[model samples]
Target: MPRIRSLFNPSGKMDKLVFVDSTKYGNHTRRAPRPGLKKGEPALKRQFSRTKYLNDLAGELNSAFRGIWPAKKSDLYQKMLKRFRKEPENRRGLLLMQLKSMEINPRYTFNSLGTCSTTVKELEESVSVGLQVQAHPPRGKYDANTYYYEVILFTWDDPNDTAFWSRQYSDWIRIGKDYPNPVFEFLFPKPSGTTLQWLLCLRVHLGVEDVVFPVLTTTGMQITDVGTFDKDEIRILEQRKQEEEKAKKKAKAAVDDIVRVKAKNQQ
Candidate 1:
């Protein structure tokens, strides 16, 4: 027999759902702007990504009982429209601040110490005398040339916090007579003070170090290390493997003794 089921649902309404063909049936390509551009688009559209939805909302609010409702600019709806055009910033603008320092302050001191280094033989001679790679027409963009210098870093914080890192300016850059030293600068889009402090402390005690850039951030002072890992991590792995090998040998020897005793008993 043919299936006999209700044409309507239990709610006594027609069991209906609007089915949409998600696959393009018509000119869907004309709906959006060209990639990588918002040129010549409406200003409101440029401001808000959901321009279509926002416009629809505005239309719905205005269409209420046309004569019964009054049109006024000072209304709450207008205020909402203004917000739609441009949003306000949060009280706390950003968590991280970028660094900026065309010049390094040699007098600057932190964590109870100060130091510098470079590729030039003369710079590494003493703790105080750091060799600034003279602008022998330093190569690269704006001829910025700097070398890496590694060191140990240590740090702590109140209550709870992550560690910081710091390393020597990787190399030196050519500066005018006005600026005496080749200032070791930092990277951009820097971390917050809390984060930077954690990074700077890395220089105090890590096998490898970073070249940090001083940056100004929404979250306050920050330093970004420009260093890589060191050989110490590799040495650690080797030590662990040796310990495992020793344990394995001890287990094998015990198993051999058990086998030998069983053979003797059989004899």
Candidate 2:
């Protein structure tokens, strides 16, 4: 019977089997993940439950800001503001995520994250607005070939606010989830005739559509100078993007036709 070898040298000229010291050639161990780096299930539940009432409020606010600045008194903002002020309790620590380019220019690809809190704690509010988008393979309800995503909006304000612990998110949609982004509008409670500066952090998960994982986390800010917004601009930008995409497809088709003709001649 032949016995299996415990150790062997590649030289094949050993007088006897020699033991090799594995400890002499060791690799570094990976660093441990930071605390709460990827932990937030209970947090998500709190966020969803608290925001269930705010969904309608958000829609109304978005509609109010849909058109031009210096809106009329009868505008949606005025109507919604009345409703906001009448609500029983004020919900602070609202973290907001917005796709900036969709409101500006398509060539611009920056997104934004911001939060709202007590005026006295403005600095804390600015520092705590960090949110990230994460993706997972299509599962259950996310049955399309496209990957499903979870966007977590974090705030450092009063830990009591459910949203302070949970993440706010949008409906899972395939459209406007990629580059050449979507027009995003966030509505927050603000006093009339005031300008406030907020610090924010935005993290985009790159390569999610292709099953690869990487994230780009950035910090910046935006100023809310007025309550009015122009919805017409968004429509114009969307039309422009559609036209540009059509032009590119036309040029590619022409090139493909030329290549096919050349190949036929060669044959």
Candidate 3:
């Protein structure tokens, strides 16, 4: 094969000559055109099937979270396809695991501003999402008062049934003051299936001279089997309670022994 340094023809074809673009060689010529695969070949069928499945899964994810953050849609699509391709056997499980920790913005995380603890509870009629945010005062910016924050609660029983709730705080957090904890209860019917997932998004905004730029970060979790979830939570609480009681008894015994020793010494 001969490499073409500069070609007048952009199409890479002129009558009998055929040109190919290769990363290794800028533009090269092949002696004869390679034979194309037959229409019903097994290898070709498998390739097509795999591509279709991955594309469908990616499309479903994009549709589920459509319009939540338009700027990152393309990146999200590519990432989902890459992940599905990597684990062909367990695409759905792997994708859900990956989404739990996926960062919306690579530059900064939501925890940088403050700390947030999220809890999801499954009620008989609805799901309750409780968020406790401890926001810190502005740093690095001279005008701290111009900074504000927003919180968005996103939940879905199934991909088709999704909900979003948002709240904005105009006042900046001051030192030695408490940031209000917000609890948003989403009225979503219990999933017929066993699992539910929710995503919490935090955005920080800086306004200067009427120009505003927002930084976003998101974290989410999946709850499978409501019965199992409640049981585990109750078990954990009971264990902690038992441990605390044991510690209190030990401390009281030590105090009583110390008092007896002091009395004996004085006598």
Candidate 4:
């Protein structure tokens, strides 16, 4: 073990050497040679292929939903990798299912708060997603009088496409003597491609005064049906375009409001 006392002593990697910082034993340096895969080895090639696919998928997912993940980025990535490894034959399908059911916050599940039901409808030129949430009685410390929920929608027509369409709805739902049932509807143009998959997530928030904070222990997520449509049938409705613009503005405003609140509190 060697101590790193200089301004730039390296704490990650430098060519053939790797550096690590350990609290108990101090800084350590070791030789970690990068291994290259040889040609014609089918078994090793398959392993490498799987590893790369998983890594790329995990990285994309983490990047796409950076601020929304319930757990640490590394932990979530490792969990997805482990689950995918268990069913190597059905990695894509398994990964989608796992993500659909993942809780943003494990300590307080969305189901504990209420019942959520979703419906998907495929029309001639567009697809519609409807979400219905029915509130339940307050349980434990989650009994906030003024709490709201937000829905996140992510859609991609092509698996290879790096850009995707996203929209979020952040409406406050006040809990009263009678539990309220809030319904949300989202519409997206049918992709010109052969297939389109959309991921939808529900997040609950607690409102204190003018500050709104996410509930770190709830989970509500689902992957909608993948639809196939003819390229000729693709058309974006003007109303849908307006709705998307509105959603984007609302999302930005929500983020800005949270930032302002945090800054005010710090002051």
Clash totals in order: 36, 3, 0, 1
Q: What is the TM-score of each candidate against the true structure?
A: 0.18, 0.21, 0.46, 0.58
Q: Could you give candidate 3's per-residue lDDT for residues 13-42 as a string of tens digits?
A: 656567876666566676554456454689
- Among all windows of 10 consecutive residues in model 3, the one with the lowest summed lDDT is 218-227
Local accuracy of candidate 4 as per-residue lDDT tens digits, 1-267: 965565654588888888977667667899885566353479878878878877776676667666665443346667656656755442343345446566544455555665667776666676677877655425346445555556665555665654354555546666665756778777756556333555566655555432554655433332332232323222333444689999999999998887433566675
TM-score result, candidate 4: 0.58
lDDT of 2 by residue, 1-267 (tens): 954444642322234333333344432233445545544568766655655545544443344333321222234433444444444333321222121112211121223322222121222212222222333222223332232222222232222332221223333334233522223323332222221222222222223244423222211122121111124433544676899999999999998887433566675
lDDT of each: 0.30, 0.32, 0.49, 0.58
Give candidate 4 regions above 4 Å deviation: 1-39, 69-74, 90-94, 137-143, 163-165, 189-195, 208-267
- Supply the TM-score for candidate 3: 0.46
lDDT for each residue of candidate 1 in 1-267, tens digit (9 for 90 to 100): 954544542322222432322233421222333454664467645546455444543343334212211322225344334444442321010111111110112122121122333221111212121233333222223232332333222222221333232234334232234544444433312233221121121121111122323321100111222111223433544675899999999999988778433566675
Give the best candidate by TM-score. Answer: 4
In model 1, the Cα lDDT at residue 155 comes to 22
Indicate the worst ten consecutive residues by lDDT in candidate 4: 225-234
Better of 1 and 2 by lDDT: 2
Ranking of all predicted structures according to TM-score, beginning with the best and ending with the worst: 4, 3, 2, 1
